[model samples]
Target: MRLSRRDALAALVAGGVGSLAGCGAPTARSSPSSREAAGDAAETPVGDHELATLVAVAEAVYPSEVEGVGEFVRTYTGSRVEGAGSYARGVAEAVGTLDDYAAEFHDIEYASLPASTRRETLEYMSVDDVAPDPDGTEAQRVRHYLVNELLYALYTSPTGASLAGLENPPGHPGGTRSYREGPDA
Candidate 1:
């Protein structure tokens, strides 16, 4: 078949228009369900809604009390960067699972009980007086994540620096002055 010049140009325009239309749709990288988009925010094994709720609760409890808590968490969520560890998520999982710990002690969910009861439940759990159940995997996971090790690291981090008031140059004076000589020349 023979084609005219005007028809050829019209066909090329139609092809260009189709290509532009396809480009407007999202690519794999931009899809809502794409793994790239999910990253650490949605990578946890826990349910998405539950994880979000836990994150919110954690922010409330800690809330950049010192300064860098939120920034540190955001940085550490996935990379495991040397200084920025995933302590925030670990803490959230641990505290949110308080209900499981409560069940081990009082046979009830932590949130289901009165505030006083919840506090008491945590107190007992903290000291191991109630004996946490190793069989409950989630509860065990929570305890594992929220231990003294994590707390210690967080307290040492910049996020907790304000609480300790660790200044750049320590306020206390050195025992020996710069010009002080050996005690017994």
Candidate 2:
């Protein structure tokens, strides 16, 4: 049987993936208004090229059944990178590495490549085989900054959580009734 997105998400949630929810909520500083209030208006949140590449990565990594991939990636990644210091730098470096690799081999930007080709390029980079590490090898960094980041964003979102049969994701408050009822109720 073909595993649908819900099936995969449900399996992950059943396997204690909820613990990964410790990735935490976006801070106030991540908001554009807050950044402007803090006098950081001059700094760009995330580069266009980098964001585009990230969107492409999300498309390749996220389950095809997930809708609004572009918007979700932009909102999630943009907030995560804004005023994020070292994390933002890491994301930029990772996207650059992926894009450069694509260009060298495919003669085009990673974001411009077809979806299947993008997946193939990631496999060629061996991102799946590498452990996610910000300071490790090229493949590791890509896994950390691109692949893992997107997964984290998706699984933590309300829509994604519901796919796994979670009515409320961590950090999001369930209603008062939720406390009175079981998870399945």
Lowest lDDT 10-residue stretch of candidate 1 = 23-32
Return the TM-score for candidate 2, rounded to 2 decimals: 0.71
**C-alpha RMSD values across all candidates:** 22.1, 9.0
- Tens-place lDDT digits, model 1, residues 16-110: 32232222121221122222235466444233333333333234334344344333333232122112123333433454566456677778654
lDDT of each: 0.36, 0.68
Candidate 2 clashing pairs? none
Query: What TM-score, computed on C-alpha atoms, does each candidate reach?
Result: 0.33, 0.71
- Among the numbered candidates, top TM-score falls to 2
**Which is the leading candidate under lDDT?**
2
lDDT tens digits by residue: candidate 2, 61-84: 878878777766765566556654
TM-score of structure candidate 1: 0.33
